[model samples]
Target: MTAFTSHFAFEFRTGIRNKNLLLMNYLFPLGLYVMMSLIMPGINPLFQATIIPSMITFGILASTLLGLPDPLVQAREAGIFRSYKINGVPALNILLIPALSTILHILVVATIITITAPIFFDAPLPVNLPVFALIVVGTAVALSGLGILIGVISPNARLTVLYSQVIFLPSMIIGGVMLPYSMLPPVAAKVALLLPSTYAMNAFNSLAMGGTADFYAWGGLLTLFVGGLTAFILAWYLFRWDSQNTGSRRHPVLALLAFVPYATWLLIV
Candidate 1:
Protein backbone atom coordinates (compact mmCIF):
# COMPACT_ATOMS: atom_id res chain seq x y z
CA MET A 1 0.00 0.00 0.00
CA THR A 2 2.79 2.39 0.89
CA ALA A 3 4.63 1.66 -2.33
CA PHE A 4 1.44 2.05 -4.35
CA THR A 5 0.72 5.38 -2.72
CA SER A 6 4.25 6.57 -3.36
CA HIS A 7 4.09 5.54 -6.99
CA PHE A 8 0.66 7.13 -7.43
CA ALA A 9 1.86 10.34 -5.85
CA PHE A 10 4.84 10.46 -8.15
CA GLU A 11 2.70 9.80 -11.23
CA PHE A 12 0.20 12.47 -10.22
CA ARG A 13 3.06 14.94 -9.90
CA THR A 14 4.31 13.92 -13.31
CA GLY A 15 0.96 14.92 -14.79
CA ILE A 16 1.85 18.49 -13.85
CA ARG A 17 5.65 18.40 -13.68
CA ASN A 18 6.65 16.86 -17.00
CA LYS A 19 6.68 19.62 -19.61
CA ASN A 20 4.83 17.70 -22.29
CA LEU A 21 2.38 16.12 -19.85
CA LEU A 22 1.79 19.49 -18.22
CA LEU A 23 1.14 21.08 -21.60
CA MET A 24 -1.30 18.42 -22.74
CA ASN A 25 -2.99 17.84 -19.37
CA TYR A 26 -3.32 21.44 -18.25
CA LEU A 27 -2.04 24.27 -20.41
CA PHE A 28 -3.18 23.01 -23.81
CA PRO A 29 -6.67 21.92 -22.81
CA LEU A 30 -7.41 24.86 -20.55
CA GLY A 31 -5.97 27.28 -23.04
CA LEU A 32 -8.08 25.81 -25.82
CA TYR A 33 -11.13 25.79 -23.57
CA VAL A 34 -10.66 29.42 -22.75
CA MET A 35 -10.05 30.32 -26.37
CA MET A 36 -13.14 28.48 -27.45
CA SER A 37 -15.20 29.92 -24.64
CA LEU A 38 -14.14 33.42 -25.56
CA ILE A 39 -14.47 33.18 -29.34
CA MET A 40 -16.97 30.46 -30.16
CA PRO A 41 -20.05 31.79 -28.39
CA GLY A 42 -19.76 34.93 -30.41
CA ILE A 43 -19.42 32.98 -33.66
CA ASN A 44 -22.33 30.66 -33.12
CA PRO A 45 -25.17 32.05 -31.05
CA LEU A 46 -26.16 28.45 -30.21
CA PHE A 47 -22.64 27.49 -29.15
CA GLN A 48 -23.07 28.59 -25.54
CA ALA A 49 -25.46 25.76 -24.71
CA THR A 50 -22.87 23.16 -25.70
CA ILE A 51 -19.66 24.88 -24.63
CA ILE A 52 -19.34 23.27 -21.23
CA PRO A 53 -19.73 19.71 -22.39
CA SER A 54 -17.71 20.11 -25.57
CA MET A 55 -14.76 21.76 -23.88
CA ILE A 56 -14.87 19.22 -21.10
CA THR A 57 -14.79 16.51 -23.74
CA PHE A 58 -11.88 18.23 -25.45
CA GLY A 59 -10.06 18.30 -22.12
CA ILE A 60 -10.50 14.55 -21.80
CA LEU A 61 -9.05 14.12 -25.30
CA ALA A 62 -6.10 16.32 -24.51
CA SER A 63 -5.37 14.71 -21.17
CA THR A 64 -5.71 11.15 -22.35
CA LEU A 65 -4.58 11.13 -25.97
CA LEU A 66 -2.04 13.90 -26.03
CA GLY A 67 -0.86 13.56 -22.43
CA LEU A 68 -0.97 9.85 -21.74
CA PRO A 69 0.54 7.54 -24.38
CA ASP A 70 4.11 8.40 -25.22
CA PRO A 71 5.40 8.10 -21.68
CA LEU A 72 4.45 4.46 -21.47
CA VAL A 73 6.19 3.73 -24.78
CA GLN A 74 9.26 5.70 -23.77
CA ALA A 75 9.33 4.07 -20.36
CA ARG A 76 9.25 0.66 -21.97
CA GLU A 77 12.09 1.64 -24.30
CA ALA A 78 14.10 3.01 -21.35
CA GLY A 79 13.57 -0.21 -19.36
CA ILE A 80 11.44 1.37 -16.61
CA PHE A 81 9.06 -1.55 -16.69
CA ARG A 82 11.99 -3.98 -16.48
CA SER A 83 13.09 -2.27 -13.27
CA TYR A 84 9.55 -2.32 -11.91
CA LYS A 85 9.31 -6.05 -12.58
CA ILE A 86 12.69 -6.71 -10.93
CA ASN A 87 11.32 -4.97 -7.84
CA GLY A 88 8.00 -6.89 -8.06
CA VAL A 89 5.66 -4.16 -9.25
CA PRO A 90 2.81 -5.76 -11.14
CA ALA A 91 2.18 -4.61 -14.72
CA LEU A 92 -1.37 -3.87 -13.69
CA ASN A 93 -0.11 -1.36 -11.19
CA ILE A 94 2.38 0.03 -13.67
CA LEU A 95 -0.40 0.70 -16.14
CA LEU A 96 -3.15 1.64 -13.70
CA ILE A 97 -1.33 4.09 -11.46
CA PRO A 98 -0.62 6.46 -14.36
CA ALA A 99 -4.17 6.11 -15.64
CA LEU A 100 -5.61 6.84 -12.21
CA SER A 101 -3.40 9.88 -11.91
CA THR A 102 -4.48 11.11 -15.36
CA ILE A 103 -8.12 10.52 -14.40
CA LEU A 104 -7.63 12.77 -11.36
CA HIS A 105 -6.14 15.48 -13.54
CA ILE A 106 -9.08 15.27 -15.96
CA LEU A 107 -11.75 15.36 -13.25
CA VAL A 108 -10.15 18.45 -11.84
CA VAL A 109 -10.05 20.01 -15.31
CA ALA A 110 -13.65 18.98 -15.97
CA THR A 111 -14.79 20.47 -12.70
CA ILE A 112 -13.03 23.68 -13.57
CA ILE A 113 -14.72 23.89 -16.99
CA THR A 114 -18.15 22.98 -15.62
CA ILE A 115 -18.01 25.68 -13.01
CA THR A 116 -16.22 28.48 -14.78
CA ALA A 117 -17.96 28.13 -18.13
CA PRO A 118 -21.25 29.15 -16.60
CA ILE A 119 -19.76 32.12 -14.79
CA PHE A 120 -17.33 33.47 -17.37
CA PHE A 121 -18.74 32.47 -20.73
CA ASP A 122 -22.41 32.07 -19.86
CA ALA A 123 -22.16 28.42 -20.85
CA PRO A 124 -24.99 26.19 -19.75
CA LEU A 125 -24.47 23.60 -17.03
CA PRO A 126 -26.00 20.14 -17.05
CA VAL A 127 -29.38 19.95 -15.40
CA ASN A 128 -28.56 16.48 -14.19
CA LEU A 129 -25.60 17.23 -11.93
CA PRO A 130 -24.99 13.70 -10.68
CA VAL A 131 -25.26 12.15 -14.12
CA PHE A 132 -23.02 14.85 -15.48
CA ALA A 133 -20.31 13.95 -12.99
CA LEU A 134 -20.81 10.25 -13.65
CA ILE A 135 -20.48 10.65 -17.39
CA VAL A 136 -17.43 12.86 -17.09
CA VAL A 137 -15.71 10.11 -15.12
CA GLY A 138 -17.10 7.59 -17.57
CA THR A 139 -15.64 9.46 -20.53
CA ALA A 140 -12.34 9.88 -18.69
CA VAL A 141 -12.05 6.17 -17.99
CA ALA A 142 -13.11 5.10 -21.46
CA LEU A 143 -10.70 7.41 -23.26
CA SER A 144 -7.84 6.79 -20.85
CA GLY A 145 -8.17 3.10 -21.53
CA LEU A 146 -7.69 3.81 -25.24
CA GLY A 147 -4.68 5.98 -24.42
CA ILE A 148 -2.97 3.29 -22.33
CA LEU A 149 -3.81 0.71 -24.93
CA ILE A 150 -2.16 2.88 -27.57
CA GLY A 151 0.96 3.13 -25.44
CA VAL A 152 0.98 -0.60 -24.91
CA ILE A 153 0.66 -1.47 -28.57
CA SER A 154 2.80 1.26 -30.11
CA PRO A 155 6.35 0.17 -30.89
CA ASN A 156 7.78 3.65 -30.42
CA ALA A 157 6.92 7.26 -29.56
CA ARG A 158 6.29 8.31 -33.19
CA LEU A 159 3.66 5.67 -33.69
CA THR A 160 2.07 6.68 -30.42
CA VAL A 161 1.47 10.15 -31.88
CA LEU A 162 0.04 8.61 -35.04
CA TYR A 163 -2.39 6.46 -33.08
CA SER A 164 -3.43 9.20 -30.68
CA GLN A 165 -3.95 11.72 -33.50
CA VAL A 166 -6.07 9.24 -35.42
CA ILE A 167 -8.65 9.67 -32.67
CA PHE A 168 -7.78 13.16 -31.45
CA LEU A 169 -8.10 15.10 -34.69
CA PRO A 170 -11.27 13.37 -35.73
CA SER A 171 -12.84 13.85 -32.33
CA MET A 172 -12.08 17.55 -32.46
CA ILE A 173 -13.50 17.82 -35.97
CA ILE A 174 -16.51 15.48 -35.99
CA GLY A 175 -16.96 13.81 -32.59
CA GLY A 176 -19.56 16.36 -31.49
CA VAL A 177 -17.12 18.63 -29.73
CA MET A 178 -16.40 21.44 -32.18
CA LEU A 179 -19.24 20.51 -34.50
CA PRO A 180 -22.72 19.47 -33.40
CA TYR A 181 -23.62 15.93 -34.36
CA SER A 182 -26.81 17.33 -35.80
CA MET A 183 -25.02 19.57 -38.26
CA LEU A 184 -22.66 16.94 -39.62
CA PRO A 185 -23.31 15.55 -43.09
CA PRO A 186 -25.03 12.17 -43.16
CA VAL A 187 -21.83 10.32 -44.08
CA ALA A 188 -19.75 12.20 -41.51
CA ALA A 189 -22.33 11.39 -38.89
CA LYS A 190 -21.98 7.71 -39.74
CA VAL A 191 -18.22 8.04 -39.40
CA ALA A 192 -18.73 9.46 -35.92
CA LEU A 193 -20.50 6.28 -34.85
CA LEU A 194 -17.07 4.70 -34.20
CA LEU A 195 -15.67 7.51 -32.05
CA PRO A 196 -16.07 7.40 -28.28
CA SER A 197 -16.41 11.19 -28.10
CA THR A 198 -19.60 10.95 -30.08
CA TYR A 199 -21.09 8.75 -27.37
CA ALA A 200 -19.72 10.98 -24.64
CA MET A 201 -21.09 14.15 -26.17
CA ASN A 202 -24.41 12.44 -26.84
CA ALA A 203 -24.62 11.36 -23.20
CA PHE A 204 -23.76 14.82 -21.95
CA ASN A 205 -26.21 16.44 -24.30
CA SER A 206 -29.23 14.18 -23.89
CA LEU A 207 -28.87 12.68 -20.42
CA ALA A 208 -27.26 15.57 -18.62
CA MET A 209 -28.11 18.64 -20.71
CA GLY A 210 -31.53 19.13 -22.32
CA GLY A 211 -30.40 18.43 -25.88
CA THR A 212 -31.63 15.39 -27.80
CA ALA A 213 -29.34 12.43 -28.35
CA ASP A 214 -28.56 11.14 -31.84
CA PHE A 215 -28.80 7.67 -30.31
CA TYR A 216 -29.92 6.33 -26.95
CA ALA A 217 -28.07 8.44 -24.42
CA TRP A 218 -28.07 5.90 -21.61
CA GLY A 219 -27.09 3.15 -24.02
CA GLY A 220 -24.14 5.21 -25.21
CA LEU A 221 -22.78 5.36 -21.67
CA LEU A 222 -23.15 1.61 -21.37
CA THR A 223 -21.21 1.18 -24.60
CA LEU A 224 -18.47 3.37 -23.21
CA PHE A 225 -18.32 1.16 -20.10
CA VAL A 226 -18.03 -2.00 -22.15
CA GLY A 227 -15.50 -0.40 -24.48
CA GLY A 228 -13.36 0.74 -21.56
CA LEU A 229 -13.46 -2.70 -19.99
CA THR A 230 -12.45 -4.30 -23.25
CA ALA A 231 -9.56 -1.86 -23.66
CA PHE A 232 -8.11 -2.41 -20.19
CA ILE A 233 -8.43 -6.18 -20.54
CA LEU A 234 -6.65 -6.05 -23.88
CA ALA A 235 -3.95 -3.77 -22.46
CA TRP A 236 -3.31 -6.28 -19.71
CA TYR A 237 -3.16 -9.19 -22.13
CA LEU A 238 -0.72 -7.41 -24.45
CA PHE A 239 1.46 -5.72 -21.85
CA ARG A 240 5.21 -6.04 -22.42
CA TRP A 241 7.64 -5.50 -19.57
CA ASP A 242 10.34 -4.20 -21.87
CA SER A 243 10.40 -3.23 -25.52
CA GLN A 244 13.23 -5.64 -26.36
CA ASN A 245 12.40 -8.53 -24.04
CA THR A 246 8.76 -9.10 -24.98
CA GLY A 247 7.97 -12.79 -25.36
CA SER A 248 5.45 -14.02 -27.88
CA ARG A 249 2.94 -11.15 -28.24
CA ARG A 250 -0.57 -10.84 -29.45
CA HIS A 251 -1.08 -9.04 -32.72
CA PRO A 252 -1.73 -5.34 -32.04
CA VAL A 253 -4.66 -5.57 -34.43
CA LEU A 254 -6.53 -7.49 -31.74
CA ALA A 255 -6.88 -4.17 -29.92
CA LEU A 256 -9.67 -3.35 -32.35
CA LEU A 257 -11.95 -5.59 -30.32
CA ALA A 258 -12.24 -2.74 -27.87
CA PHE A 259 -14.42 -1.01 -30.42
CA VAL A 260 -16.88 -3.89 -30.60
CA PRO A 261 -19.26 -2.17 -28.24
CA TYR A 262 -19.24 1.02 -30.28
CA ALA A 263 -19.51 -0.81 -33.57
CA THR A 264 -22.23 -3.06 -32.21
CA TRP A 265 -24.24 -0.04 -31.19
CA LEU A 266 -23.71 1.46 -34.61
CA LEU A 267 -25.06 -1.68 -36.23
CA ILE A 268 -27.95 -2.22 -33.84
CA VAL A 269 -29.20 1.32 -34.10
Candidate 2:
Protein backbone atom coordinates (compact mmCIF):
# COMPACT_ATOMS: atom_id res chain seq x y z
CA MET A 1 0.00 0.00 0.00
CA THR A 2 2.84 2.36 0.84
CA ALA A 3 4.59 1.43 -2.34
CA PHE A 4 1.46 2.13 -4.36
CA THR A 5 1.00 5.48 -2.67
CA SER A 6 4.62 6.43 -3.18
CA HIS A 7 4.56 5.47 -6.84
CA PHE A 8 1.29 7.25 -7.33
CA ALA A 9 2.79 10.42 -5.91
CA PHE A 10 5.83 10.12 -8.12
CA GLU A 11 3.71 9.62 -11.22
CA PHE A 12 1.48 12.55 -10.34
CA ARG A 13 4.50 14.79 -9.98
CA THR A 14 5.88 13.62 -13.29
CA GLY A 15 2.61 14.44 -14.99
CA ILE A 16 2.57 17.95 -13.52
CA ARG A 17 6.13 18.58 -14.68
CA ASN A 18 5.18 18.14 -18.31
CA LYS A 19 3.87 21.60 -19.08
CA ASN A 20 2.16 20.87 -22.39
CA LEU A 21 0.50 17.76 -21.12
CA LEU A 22 -0.45 19.52 -17.92
CA LEU A 23 -2.10 22.31 -19.86
CA MET A 24 -4.01 19.96 -22.09
CA ASN A 25 -5.07 17.76 -19.21
CA TYR A 26 -6.22 20.64 -17.07
CA LEU A 27 -7.15 23.50 -19.36
CA PHE A 28 -8.08 22.08 -22.75
CA PRO A 29 -11.45 20.77 -21.72
CA LEU A 30 -12.33 23.94 -19.88
CA GLY A 31 -11.25 25.87 -22.92
CA LEU A 32 -13.57 23.80 -25.05
CA TYR A 33 -16.44 24.40 -22.66
CA VAL A 34 -15.82 28.15 -22.60
CA MET A 35 -15.53 28.25 -26.37
CA MET A 36 -18.75 26.39 -26.85
CA SER A 37 -20.44 28.67 -24.40
CA LEU A 38 -19.33 31.72 -26.29
CA ILE A 39 -20.11 30.38 -29.75
CA MET A 40 -23.53 28.99 -28.98
CA PRO A 41 -24.82 31.67 -26.64
CA GLY A 42 -28.40 31.03 -27.64
CA ILE A 43 -28.54 27.29 -26.85
CA ASN A 44 -30.73 26.08 -23.99
CA PRO A 45 -29.14 26.07 -20.56
CA LEU A 46 -29.97 22.38 -20.16
CA PHE A 47 -28.12 21.55 -23.36
CA GLN A 48 -25.18 23.68 -22.25
CA ALA A 49 -25.16 21.89 -18.93
CA THR A 50 -24.78 18.60 -20.72
CA ILE A 51 -21.80 20.00 -22.65
CA ILE A 52 -19.87 20.72 -19.47
CA PRO A 53 -20.07 17.10 -18.33
CA SER A 54 -19.30 15.79 -21.77
CA MET A 55 -16.22 17.99 -21.90
CA ILE A 56 -15.19 16.84 -18.45
CA THR A 57 -15.47 13.21 -19.55
CA PHE A 58 -13.55 14.06 -22.71
CA GLY A 59 -10.83 15.60 -20.56
CA ILE A 60 -10.65 12.40 -18.54
CA LEU A 61 -10.48 10.27 -21.67
CA ALA A 62 -7.87 12.50 -23.34
CA SER A 63 -5.52 12.68 -20.39
CA THR A 64 -5.66 8.99 -19.62
CA LEU A 65 -5.90 7.35 -23.03
CA LEU A 66 -4.31 9.91 -25.34
CA GLY A 67 -2.00 12.40 -23.62
CA LEU A 68 -0.53 10.08 -21.00
CA PRO A 69 0.34 7.02 -23.09
CA ASP A 70 2.65 8.42 -25.72
CA PRO A 71 5.40 9.37 -23.32
CA LEU A 72 4.93 6.15 -21.34
CA VAL A 73 5.43 4.05 -24.45
CA GLN A 74 8.58 5.96 -25.29
CA ALA A 75 9.87 5.54 -21.74
CA ARG A 76 9.26 1.79 -21.91
CA GLU A 77 11.18 1.60 -25.18
CA ALA A 78 14.05 3.42 -23.49
CA GLY A 79 14.26 0.78 -20.74
CA ILE A 80 12.46 2.72 -18.02
CA PHE A 81 10.08 -0.13 -17.28
CA ARG A 82 13.00 -2.57 -17.12
CA SER A 83 14.84 -0.38 -14.60
CA TYR A 84 11.72 -0.23 -12.43
CA LYS A 85 11.21 -3.99 -12.75
CA ILE A 86 14.74 -4.61 -11.55
CA ASN A 87 14.36 -2.12 -8.68
CA GLY A 88 12.00 -4.54 -6.89
CA VAL A 89 8.91 -2.68 -8.09
CA PRO A 90 5.99 -4.96 -8.81
CA ALA A 91 4.46 -4.69 -12.24
CA LEU A 92 1.20 -3.58 -10.72
CA ASN A 93 2.93 -0.85 -8.75
CA ILE A 94 4.56 0.37 -11.92
CA LEU A 95 1.15 0.54 -13.52
CA LEU A 96 -0.33 2.33 -10.49
CA ILE A 97 1.71 5.50 -10.98
CA PRO A 98 0.08 6.62 -14.21
CA ALA A 99 -3.31 5.24 -13.27
CA LEU A 100 -3.34 7.19 -10.03
CA SER A 101 -2.10 10.32 -11.70
CA THR A 102 -4.89 10.13 -14.21
CA ILE A 103 -7.40 9.73 -11.41
CA LEU A 104 -6.08 12.78 -9.65
CA HIS A 105 -6.25 14.69 -12.87
CA ILE A 106 -9.89 13.72 -13.29
CA LEU A 107 -10.75 14.74 -9.74
CA VAL A 108 -9.19 18.15 -10.13
CA VAL A 109 -10.90 18.65 -13.46
CA ALA A 110 -14.24 17.49 -12.09
CA THR A 111 -13.93 19.84 -9.15
CA ILE A 112 -13.32 22.70 -11.50
CA ILE A 113 -16.37 21.74 -13.50
CA THR A 114 -18.50 21.45 -10.38
CA ILE A 115 -17.45 24.85 -9.06
CA THR A 116 -17.76 26.69 -12.32
CA ALA A 117 -20.72 24.88 -13.80
CA PRO A 118 -23.36 26.83 -11.91
CA ILE A 119 -21.68 30.14 -12.62
CA PHE A 120 -21.50 29.62 -16.37
CA PHE A 121 -24.75 27.74 -16.75
CA ASP A 122 -27.77 27.38 -14.49
CA ALA A 123 -27.66 23.57 -14.50
CA PRO A 124 -28.95 21.94 -11.35
CA LEU A 125 -26.61 20.02 -9.12
CA PRO A 126 -26.53 16.29 -9.68
CA VAL A 127 -29.60 14.50 -8.29
CA ASN A 128 -27.54 11.78 -6.63
CA LEU A 129 -24.16 13.19 -5.80
CA PRO A 130 -22.79 9.87 -4.58
CA VAL A 131 -23.72 8.03 -7.76
CA PHE A 132 -22.40 10.86 -9.92
CA ALA A 133 -19.09 10.84 -8.04
CA LEU A 134 -18.88 7.06 -8.39
CA ILE A 135 -19.38 7.24 -12.13
CA VAL A 136 -16.61 9.83 -12.46
CA VAL A 137 -14.13 7.90 -10.33
CA GLY A 138 -14.98 4.55 -11.89
CA THR A 139 -14.68 5.90 -15.40
CA ALA A 140 -11.30 7.45 -14.59
CA VAL A 141 -9.98 4.21 -13.08
CA ALA A 142 -11.10 2.12 -16.03
CA LEU A 143 -9.75 4.53 -18.61
CA SER A 144 -6.43 4.92 -16.79
CA GLY A 145 -5.96 1.15 -16.76
CA LEU A 146 -6.56 1.05 -20.48
CA GLY A 147 -4.06 3.89 -20.98
CA ILE A 148 -1.34 1.97 -19.15
CA LEU A 149 -2.15 -1.04 -21.30
CA ILE A 150 -1.76 1.02 -24.43
CA GLY A 151 1.58 2.34 -23.19
CA VAL A 152 2.75 -1.24 -22.72
CA ILE A 153 1.75 -2.42 -26.19
CA SER A 154 2.08 0.47 -28.63
CA PRO A 155 4.91 -0.03 -31.12
CA ASN A 156 6.27 3.48 -30.90
CA ALA A 157 5.47 7.03 -29.86
CA ARG A 158 4.33 7.88 -33.38
CA LEU A 159 1.92 5.00 -33.42
CA THR A 160 0.72 5.89 -29.95
CA VAL A 161 -0.02 9.46 -31.01
CA LEU A 162 -1.67 8.30 -34.21
CA TYR A 163 -3.77 5.67 -32.53
CA SER A 164 -4.81 7.88 -29.62
CA GLN A 165 -5.97 10.66 -31.92
CA VAL A 166 -7.79 8.23 -34.14
CA ILE A 167 -9.63 6.81 -31.17
CA PHE A 168 -10.22 10.00 -29.16
CA LEU A 169 -11.22 12.75 -31.61
CA PRO A 170 -14.09 11.00 -33.33
CA SER A 171 -15.22 9.56 -30.03
CA MET A 172 -15.36 12.99 -28.41
CA ILE A 173 -16.98 14.77 -31.34
CA ILE A 174 -19.61 12.16 -32.08
CA GLY A 175 -20.18 11.23 -28.45
CA GLY A 176 -21.78 14.65 -27.98
CA VAL A 177 -18.98 16.92 -26.92
CA MET A 178 -19.82 19.69 -29.39
CA LEU A 179 -23.16 18.30 -30.55
CA PRO A 180 -26.01 16.73 -28.60
CA TYR A 181 -26.83 13.06 -29.11
CA SER A 182 -30.30 14.06 -30.23
CA MET A 183 -28.85 16.07 -33.10
CA LEU A 184 -26.74 13.29 -34.56
CA PRO A 185 -27.88 11.16 -37.50
CA PRO A 186 -29.06 7.60 -36.89
CA VAL A 187 -25.86 5.96 -38.16
CA ALA A 188 -23.72 8.50 -36.34
CA ALA A 189 -25.71 8.00 -33.17
CA LYS A 190 -25.20 4.25 -33.43
CA VAL A 191 -21.47 4.74 -33.95
CA ALA A 192 -21.31 7.21 -31.05
CA LEU A 193 -22.93 4.61 -28.79
CA LEU A 194 -19.99 2.34 -29.50
CA LEU A 195 -17.62 4.66 -27.63
CA PRO A 196 -17.29 5.01 -23.85
CA SER A 197 -17.75 8.77 -24.12
CA THR A 198 -21.37 8.21 -25.09
CA TYR A 199 -22.07 6.57 -21.75
CA ALA A 200 -20.31 9.35 -19.91
CA MET A 201 -22.37 11.95 -21.76
CA ASN A 202 -25.62 10.14 -21.09
CA ALA A 203 -24.81 9.87 -17.41
CA PHE A 204 -23.98 13.55 -17.21
CA ASN A 205 -26.99 14.56 -19.24
CA SER A 206 -29.27 12.61 -16.94
CA LEU A 207 -27.97 14.53 -13.97
CA ALA A 208 -28.05 17.95 -15.64
CA MET A 209 -31.17 17.79 -17.78
CA GLY A 210 -33.71 16.32 -15.36
CA GLY A 211 -31.88 16.11 -12.02
CA THR A 212 -32.66 12.40 -12.29
CA ALA A 213 -30.63 9.26 -12.44
CA ASP A 214 -31.36 6.58 -15.01
CA PHE A 215 -30.21 3.30 -16.55
CA TYR A 216 -28.05 5.09 -19.10
CA ALA A 217 -25.71 6.29 -16.38
CA TRP A 218 -25.64 2.81 -14.88
CA GLY A 219 -24.92 1.35 -18.30
CA GLY A 220 -22.02 3.75 -18.72
CA LEU A 221 -20.58 2.75 -15.37
CA LEU A 222 -20.95 -0.94 -16.28
CA THR A 223 -19.28 -0.44 -19.64
CA LEU A 224 -16.31 1.27 -18.02
CA PHE A 225 -15.96 -1.43 -15.33
CA VAL A 226 -16.18 -4.40 -17.69
CA GLY A 227 -14.28 -2.82 -20.57
CA GLY A 228 -11.46 -1.67 -18.30
CA LEU A 229 -11.16 -5.16 -16.79
CA THR A 230 -10.83 -6.75 -20.22
CA ALA A 231 -8.17 -4.25 -21.24
CA PHE A 232 -6.17 -4.84 -18.07
CA ILE A 233 -6.24 -8.61 -18.62
CA LEU A 234 -5.06 -8.26 -22.18
CA ALA A 235 -2.34 -5.83 -21.13
CA TRP A 236 -1.07 -8.31 -18.55
CA TYR A 237 -0.97 -11.04 -21.16
CA LEU A 238 0.51 -8.99 -24.00
CA PHE A 239 2.85 -6.41 -22.41
CA ARG A 240 6.50 -6.88 -23.25
CA TRP A 241 8.96 -5.40 -20.78
CA ASP A 242 11.46 -4.91 -23.54
CA SER A 243 10.40 -3.11 -26.70
CA GLN A 244 12.96 -5.03 -28.81
CA ASN A 245 11.01 -8.15 -28.02
CA THR A 246 8.21 -8.34 -30.56
CA GLY A 247 4.82 -9.33 -29.19
CA SER A 248 2.43 -11.78 -30.79
CA ARG A 249 0.84 -10.72 -34.06
CA ARG A 250 -2.30 -10.92 -31.94
CA HIS A 251 -2.48 -7.13 -31.56
CA PRO A 252 -5.38 -6.93 -33.98
CA VAL A 253 -7.20 -9.72 -32.21
CA LEU A 254 -6.81 -7.93 -28.90
CA ALA A 255 -7.94 -4.66 -30.44
CA LEU A 256 -11.08 -6.36 -31.65
CA LEU A 257 -11.73 -7.65 -28.16
CA ALA A 258 -11.37 -4.13 -26.76
CA PHE A 259 -14.01 -2.94 -29.18
CA VAL A 260 -16.50 -5.67 -28.27
CA PRO A 261 -18.23 -4.16 -25.24
CA TYR A 262 -18.90 -0.81 -26.85
CA ALA A 263 -19.98 -2.49 -30.09
CA THR A 264 -22.33 -4.77 -28.21
CA TRP A 265 -23.77 -1.80 -26.34
CA LEU A 266 -24.34 -0.03 -29.64
CA LEU A 267 -26.24 -2.98 -30.99
CA ILE A 268 -28.36 -3.60 -27.92
CA VAL A 269 -28.83 -0.11 -26.50
C-alpha lDDT values of all predictions: 0.90, 0.71
lDDT of 1 at 145: 91
Off by over 4 Å in 1: none
Clash counts per candidate, in order, are 0, 0
**Candidate 1 per-residue C-alpha lDDT over 5-90 given as tens digits, one digit per residue, 9 for 90 to 100:** 99999999999999999998989989999998899878988889998889889999999988899999999999999999999999
RMSD of each: 1.1, 2.5
Q: Which regions in candidate 2 have their CA more than 4 angstroms from the true location? A: 43-46, 207-216, 247-252
Model 2 clashing-pair count: 0
* TM-score of every candidate: 0.97, 0.88
| Per-residue C-alpha lDDT of model 2 across residues 1-269, encoded as one tens digit per residue | 68777888777887778875686578676787677656664765545556556657878887887767777787788898789888887776666667777788888888788777778765445666776777787677667766777776778888787767766877778866667777788888888876667666666667444544324667777887787777766766666667776746656347547667777876565
- Number of the top candidate by lDDT? 1
